[model samples]
Target chain A: MKAKVIVKLKEGVLDPQGQAIQQLLAQRGYSQIADVRVGKLVEFELENVTPIEGEAMLAEIADKLLANPIIESYRIESQ
Target chain B: MSIAVITFPGSNCDRDCLHVLQNVIGAPARFVFHKETDLGDCTGVLVPGGFSYGDYLRAGALAKISPIMPAIHRFADAGGPVLGICNGFQILCEVGLLPGALMLNRNLRFISRWVDLRVENSDTLFTRHLWQDQIVRMPIAHAEGNFTVEPETIAKIVAKQQIVFKYAGPVREDSPDGNPNGSTLSIAGIVNEAGNVMGMMPHPDRASEAILGSTDGIPIFRAFAEAAQEKSRLEYSY
Candidate 1:
């Protein structure tokens, strides 16, 4: 089994890296950029756990380690 | 007692911090590896800077859970002095020992230069030697140092005087110290609610010597050394 966690900076937190990329694209004639927010995807390989167990553990991992609640949020997708 | 300069894998500033403690401040210090579970006979904990865990996931995220961290927590719980500089600061925040999180610099660039910081709260054991609102300069080298916190938390930080230093004075855009990192309230350093732990983005250890261009960093280290020594003495006095 496998699992994934998508971590994103909170809605109002400044995403400077994303903004820089958005600006870079604008310079290359890519217009109509409303907003660019950056985030990270973490893929994990799970062993011998049912999908429910995997999701439960992933939630704890995301809450405790993968994402910092202060500035970021994480959503887990189990497969 | 000695200051335990924590060395996570890839920590580049551990030596600098050790130098400041052992040589400059005349305080005993030793290196404690991240894999170690005990902090040994140390009264002070110094979490130095560098790209720990290669800044993966987040700057200080992985290093926060290092084996040595639980000992640090125990030490901190006993009112021990724990100072985190640069990457160390991020680790403290990641571990929830301090409030706020450092995000990418607002300009999307790695800033490495001196920053003008005004001492905000001199009451902490970390900042006792410095006076309130005294402007000091220290080298800040980092990419993700723009500290942020929830809106409601800012009020508590201000009210409780958790903020220890703030970027202030005239900031020039064309100078070597140009480009502010956009930290909330311009905070450069902060102490926890108990004032036992402190975290700051700048390198005070790098500035502890006069020949390094400024002696302002001495007072900060000196204050912590004295405080840590006092705490150790208190523990043994019983």
Candidate 2:
């Protein structure tokens, strides 16, 4: 089983990098840019793990390693 | 009065914080590496500023996931006093210990200079020694220090008096030209919901000694020490 984690700044949190990119695009003559927000994606491969087990393990990872939980929120999905 | 300053990779102000606590304030302070999970017997933890993890990914993105952060969360949960300065503040926000996020400077530039900050609330452990509406000069250095939060949350923060510090004078009130990073609400520092943890963009440790051109930062640290001592005495009396 492979799990993917998508982490992003929670809504209402300012994203400086995204704002910078938007400005650069506008300066380059791309005037239609509406907004940009940057996020991180992490993919992990787990073998012989059930969905329940994977969720429990992923929660631990979120708590200890993956997300800061303060400014960023994360979602996990298996494919 | 045992204080511990957490040192992450690229943390330049760790020594400054330790020096202020140990030498200037005469408190027992130690440097705790980012890998150490145990905070030992320290009553207060200082997360000093600097480009932790080289400010890669985000200002405090990588450093927020450090091994010691779990311990930090535990420390805050136990009602221990924690102060996050500059990049340390960013990290605290990144780790969800504090509210809001630090965005890029509204001017789109790196800011490195001294600015005036008005103490908004003097009731916090980090500000109890200072008078309300007092102004102090402190240095801020960062590419991303703009604080942003939802309007509704901002109202709640104001209603709860969680705002600890704000950019003061015309320089901070007049946004864009006056504000360094275009922080929403001109907020520079704020305490957590519990009021025990604080994260601020200004470097108070840098202002602690007279040799640094100002001793205004003394009261902030002294407040922490006093609060910690008072808490300890209460714990022992029980």
Candidate 3:
């Protein structure tokens, strides 16, 4: 089994990197960019794990390694 | 007073922190490697500044997940004092030890300069030696020091008096214009809810010595030492 975790800054939190990228795109004449937010995608490969177990493992990873709960949130999906 | 300074692979300020704590403060402070599991008999832990792991993914993204952090977290949860400075601060935030997040400078530039900070709350062990509203000069060098959180969370932080330091003077009057980095509310540092852990973007260790152009950082260490002493006394009173 494989799991993918998508981490993003929580709402109302400032995304400076996203804003910088947006600015760069605008400068490059890609003005159609209405919004841009940067996030991280982490993939995990596991064997003999159920979806629930995978989710629990991903939560552990998010809390202990992948995401900083103070400002980032994560979603886990199994494949 | 034994102090442990955690040193990640790319940490450049571990020696500086060790020097200040050992020489100036006369404390037994040692540099602990990131891969080290033992914290020894240290009473307090100091996460010094510098680009840990070259700040590959994020300012402190990788360093926070190092093998030693779980031990650091256990130490902190046991009511131990932990001070995170600059890159250390970012690691704390990245590890969820502190609230809020540090984003890239609003100007999108790497900032390296000395700025004045106003002491907001001096009740913590980290700031007890300083008077309220006391101004101190410290150097900040980071590309992502701009702090941000939800408005409700900001209000909660203010209500809990978690905010410890804010930029002083007109230099950081406005987020984007004044300070080299555009920090929200011009926040320089803050303590965790438990008050035992603190994370700040400015390098207080850098300002501890007179030869470093400023000695304003002395009171912070003094306060921590005094607080530790007081706590020890209280614990033994029983």
Tens digit of lDDT per residue, candidate 2, span B82-198? 899999999988887888778778777898888888889999889988999999888888888998876777888899999998987445443534567888788999999899999
- Model 2 C-alpha RMSD vs. true structure (Å) is 3.6
DockQ-derived CAPRI band for the predicted complex in model 1: high
Off by over 4 Å in 2: A1-28, A32-79, B169-177, B233-238
Model 3 agreement with the true structure over B1-238: per-residue lDDT tens digits:
5678999999999999888887898776788899987676667788889999998867898987688888888777777788999999998888878888888787778888888899999899899888999989989888888887767788988989999999874455444345557666778899999899999998888899888899988888776655544444223211
lDDT (C-alpha, whole model) for all candidates? 0.88, 0.83, 0.82
The residue-by-residue lDDT of candidate 1 on B1-238, one tens digit each, is 8889999997999999999888998988899999999877788899999999999889999997789988888888778889999999999999988999998888878988887888999888988888898989889999999999999999999999999998874467633243378788788899999999999998998788889988888998999888878876357321
Best by DockQ: 1
For residue B54, give model 3's deviation from the true position in Å. 2.9
**Count of clashing pairs, candidate 3:** 0
* TM-score of decoy 2: 0.82
User: What DockQ was computed for model 3?
Assistant: 0.52
DockQ of each: 0.87, 0.31, 0.52
Query: Top model by lDDT, which number?
Result: 1
Candidates 1 and 3 compared by lDDT, better number: 1
- Greater-lDDT candidate between 2 and 3: 2
Candidate 2 has which clashing residue pairs, if any?
A70-B96
| CAPRI rating of model 2 | acceptable
Alpha-carbon runs more than 4 Å astray in model 1: B174-179, B233-238
Predicted candidate 3 versus true structure: per-residue lDDT over A1-79, tens digit per residue: 8889999988766777898889899999999997799999988899888888878988987777777666778888887
